[model samples]
Target chain A: MAIEVNGKMIEIDEEGFLVDREDWSEDVSEAIAGRDGIELKDEHIGLIDYFRDYYEEHQVHPTMRVLVLRLGGKIGKKFHDHKEYEKFLYMLFPSDPISELCKLAGLPKPLPSEHDG
Target chain B: MAKKNDEKGTTNPELNIPLLNELEEGQWPSFVSDLKQWSKTKPQVAQLLNQLEESYENRWNYWTGTVLNVSGYGGGVIARLSEKADKYPDLAEFHTIRVIPPPGFVYSTERLRNLADICEKHGAGILQLHGLTGDALALGFDNEGTFAAAEELMANGWDLGGSGPALRSLQCCVGQARCEMACFDTMKTTRFLTNHYISFLHRPELMYKFKIKVSGCANDCANAMIGSDMPIIGTWRGPMQIDQEKVAEYIEEKGVEHVIDNVITRCPTNCLSLKGKQMVVDNENCVRCMHCINVMHKALKPGKDRGVTICLGAKRTLKIGDTMSSVIVPFMKLETEEDFQNLTDLIDRMWEFWNDNGMDHERIGEFIARVGLATFLEGCGIDPDPRMVQSTRTSPYIKFEELAPGLFEGEQTQQPKVWNREPDTREPSD
Candidate 1:
């Protein structure tokens, strides 16, 4: 399957992940998030960027706990505690922050075992 | 979708189940006899027996598939399908619904009857009073039948137990309800924790299965120490209560030789001794192993100040091997709501650390093994306690520089040298 971004057709997998990582761009992310009825905000994009960076460095997606911990060191001075930061992340992507961020970031879907309840 | 079995018929009398007949010949009560008795009224049982016989003959289990979950849930229903369904069509889709029983497993006759009726109507007429994990097993159902039975069970105040990666049903001993040695109310604590984490029980999203078992005292009737991820065991601080009169009476009845052989010698801490006719306990040295109290319940009792000891990271053999739980919190007063909330917060912290660091299919215990226990404790922000360690380090290679920085500085003008040298920074050789 495929989705159209900026009038150019881009291939995607059945779960809507990008068929090619190189095909991913800002416009493609917006198109993917738009399909899920989520308007891409700056915070969402920030997490998406972190997800891409972490994956590039570690060859794995950052778990919710790792994301919260690393993000706290990076841009979480506003939040008093890690729990509050986690709550903020959840508020940004309520269903599953890690998987949702990965999708918008154009990364492969995480293992089902890593998904939270 | 499969059709329901014809409930009007009985077992075929001409059918020869030679393998199953052998099971009924034993002196001990046999499950074969029970199944045969139920087969008289429920044809599903007879078909299941036939399937079992076929499995025994072929040296292979016919059961497979796990797509028997109820709506909006991913667990609690285990599929038991027969691969030989073409031959035993009636036994094609056998399943078991795991219903979470109440804390303490107290049940009224009416509730039991209702459960039996539901099983008979929507499932095969068989009820395993309790499964290994303490959930009531309602056996033998198809896909649609499972939904029907689950809906009726929920409406009648019964909920399904957990399976897969979810938090399993909380198992608690009948504490304070019937047991005299109980240090706290096991039922209340179990019920509260269960209700609080009901979502975790119903959902299947964790890395692997987690279990919590509560025991009322150090006797650990619930097998909390080795069988669960989180073990809440009742414990006491300070001296245990000892009635001298009752002690004398016990000595009179059981004899001094019996007391010396059974209670005194068996004390793990070697704190118990006899002073004339009265028994003496070295309270300061007592580890509260519950051996003396169990043997002489009439004379000895738990201390007045009682609470629970919470431990973490226990599981059966899997990755690293069987590991017993380690004490995290030596004592926690589980009386007030705030206390329970604090316990919940601790669990949340531990779970967060585990979920982030744990690999797929890795239990919390294995996670601790991968990352050192000190790292796990520090990551969860748990205060390091002396009781958490089984014993002080026996090796002389202690990190004294990190532990005690300036112990010998002022006293001897000699500094403690750090034993661990810096890593070799030289380039690799060809």
Candidate 2:
């Protein structure tokens, strides 16, 4: 499958995940987020950026335990305990935080077998 | 292992494997799409991938076809012609039939070969070895072909598998027939259940499907622990059989320290102890996890006085979260026909309750969650036992004597205080 952005064809896979990683841009993120009825807030963008950076470092998707520990140091404030930040995270993405972030970050859809962070 | 970015801000060519790089970018990259794209040069593989992708993408649509209902005593024969019959003319005869095998799935090699040959003659030369239940599926038969296959199967002493909202094929682990640890005949109990509920197997009278799985021992290789509605797990009540001579022989060959470190020390509940030259087991503390017996098979064996532990409410998360069954019957002797009758009666009572009260598509576990465990127990005529208590209690509350004093003096004539009343809005604002 392919998505037409500004009349330029950008390739994607069957599940609407980007086929090419380098094809990602801020415009692409906005378009993807719009599809899921999510208007990207500044914090949402920050999360997506963080996820992309983290994914670049780690080949495998991080579990919730790894996220809570790493995000505490990187983003700090109220992230000291998982319970403190969990409410806010869910508020930002009602379905799944990782799924929403990944979509906006121009990544593939997580497999049914994949565990969420 | 963070790799450095090039001056051009793109990942280095050496670091980029298209599929691996796609997977690293925060999503589950489609290997199917990758395979299709990679096999562009290979037309045959690409064509096969295209067929598979089409089947996946439009699966729900393809599943719809002529629902062939056989006028028979059994229920699980769901044979449907593929909706894609028009597009793929060769697939016009594509009909799948799910066939239930005998309990313990004991099939002779010749019988299996015969079934395969029958499938090849009528349908596509394939058998789906495993289905959602214990039944095997024969895929790719036409209307006429499927009937012929079913006739052959019946003639060969095979019957249709269970389907619809009914009892599926009862699954069981090989019991005393093969395994040394088996307490009772799992196959015998399974056959009894299957024969008695044979009519229920073919009828869609219930709200949802019910599964009954039996395991010969606590090792639970059959996975009845979390999958079945009534999970019959075998357990030993008496102390484990410990051969002193065998233990001495093992110790002499493998060393006493080795036995203690490897076998005795590994007991999860610390129920096993090595005293001088004898091994002692604290039977009360034993959880019957089958770990120790598995470790030292020569010296240790399951107790002779064996039966089954009946558990209820095991199912996948639907309305409620995924729940493992709670022990309803701690231990029950299954040797006598009367005992087996009592067990079947319990199952019937539970099913009757569920059929009456269960919502559409609601599993028994979900129904129990909505109605509460106490109600379910009462309906099933089961007395409440401490062993039936579930571990996931949200309220960790214990009432004290001091708090109980208020219960006796509950009817005090004191007027209740009220606060935060809304201001009177009867008059219009000036």
TM-score of every model?
0.75, 0.62
For model 2, residues B250-355, the per-residue Cα lDDT tens digits are 8888898898898888888788888877789999888888987887888899998989999877887667788888787889999898999788778867876776
In order, what fnat does every candidate score? Answer: 0.02, 0.00
Encode model 1's per-residue lDDT on B23-88: one tens digit a residue.
Answer: 889589998888888887777678788878888999998877634446556568877777876666
Instruction: Please write out the lDDT profile of model 2 over residues A8-108, one tens digit for every residue.
Output: 88887654568887899988887767766778889898888887877788754543334544564345332222333444565676545655667677766
Which DockQ-derived CAPRI band holds candidate 1? Answer: incorrect
Q: Which of the numbered candidates is closest to the native, going by highest TM-score? A: 1
Error of 2 at A11 (Å): 47
**Candidate 2 DockQ vs. native:** 0.01
Worst 10 residues of 1 chain B by lDDT: B390-399
